[model samples]
Target chain A: MKARVTITLKPGVLDPQGKAIEHALDNLGFSGVEAARAGKVIELDLADGTSDADIDAMCRKLLANTVIENYRIERL
Target chain B: MKARVTITLKPGVLDPQGKAIEHALDNLGFSGVEAARAGKVIELDLADGTSDADIDAMCRKLLANTVIENYRIERL
Candidate 1:
């Protein structure tokens, strides 16, 4: 089984990295880019029968920094 | 309008950062982990009525590295 976990900063959190990327894009002549926020994606290949609850636990425990990010898990 | 673009490495590409993170997780005693692939998420705040095709073009032109990554756009 495979799962994809996406971790994104919560709204109102400062994202200096994303801001830097946005500036880079503007310098590259990519216009009309209003704002940018960057996050992370983590893909996991796990044993079959890995429950959703277990995956959620994984996100809360290790995959996501709940202090500043939210995570969503998708099973494939 | 807003769009979220997720960029992930193509399968078979080496992901050293993900490997390092996996090792860190293991060191933290989070077990049952198999493999980890890391990627990026970019959120864009755009003008109202930004078309999906335009968003896709942005991904191709500036947001994603087509050589090693694939992107998906979601509107919110």
Candidate 2:
């Protein structure tokens, strides 16, 4: 099975990395970019028949800091 | 308008961060993970009518390193 985990900061969380990118883009003369939020995407190759619950558990246990980030799982 | 840029290492490139994650997952007892690839996702809040060419330019010039990375842009 193949799964993709997208981890993003929760709303209202400060993202210094994202802010840095935004500023860099502006300095590069690509104007009109209101904001940018940086996040992580992890693609996993798993054994066939890996259950959704197991995937969720992986996200909660290690893939994400639940207090400040959110994760979405997609099985492919 | 909103846009997303997904930046991933080109196949065959070494990814130490991903390997570290794979090892950590194994140590944490989540088996069946054959491999893992780490990537970045940047969400952009842009002015309405931002052109696709402009977005592509952003990816090529700063958002991704074309020599060892691949980037996909999606408009939302």
Candidate 3:
């Protein structure tokens, strides 16, 4: 089974990297890009029996910073 | 309009960051995770007139590292 984890900054959290990316786009002449965010994706090939609870545990324990980020787990 | 770009390491490319993440998972005792990948997601809030070609240009010019990474753009 495959699982995909998407981690994004929590609402109201400061994202300097995102701001930097927005600026880079502006320099590249993409001034129409109003706002931008930079996040991370983690793909995992897991054992067949891996449960949703197990994946959730993995996110909370290591994959994401709960205080500043929110992660969604998708099983494929 | 919103656009999403997912940038992932090209196959056979060196991904030290991904490997490091895998190792970290191992240390956290997630032995069932067979293979893992680390990638980037860029979310953009763009002007309504932004065309697919313009978004593609952004990826080619600034958003993605074309040599080691492949990026997919989704408009929403």
**lDDT string, candidate 2, A23-52, tens digits:** 999999999899999999999999998889
Query: Which runs of model 2 end up more than 4 angstroms from their true locations?
Result: none
**Cα lDDT tens digits for candidate 3, B1-76:** 9999999998999878778878888898888888889999998999999999999999989878898889999887
Clashes of each: 0, 0, 0
lDDT of 2 by residue, B1-76 (tens): 9999999999999999899889988998888899999999999999998899999999999999999999999997
Indicate the residue-level lDDT of B30 in model 2: 84
Ranking the candidates on DockQ from highest down gives 2, 3, 1
Better of 1 and 3 by DockQ: 3
Question: Model 3: how far is A19 from its true place, Å?
Answer: 0.9
Candidate 2 DockQ, CA atoms: 0.89
Chain A TM-scores, all candidates? 0.96, 0.98, 0.97
Q: Which ten residues in a row have the lowest lDDT in candidate 1 chain A?
A: A24-33
Model 1 ranges with Cα > 4 A deviation: A28-30, B26-31
User: In model 3, what are the clashing residue pairs, if there are any?
Assistant: none
Q: lDDT tens digits, residues A1-76, model 1?
A: 8889989999999999889877976786656678999999998877777788878887887889999999989987
State which candidate has the highest TM-score: 2
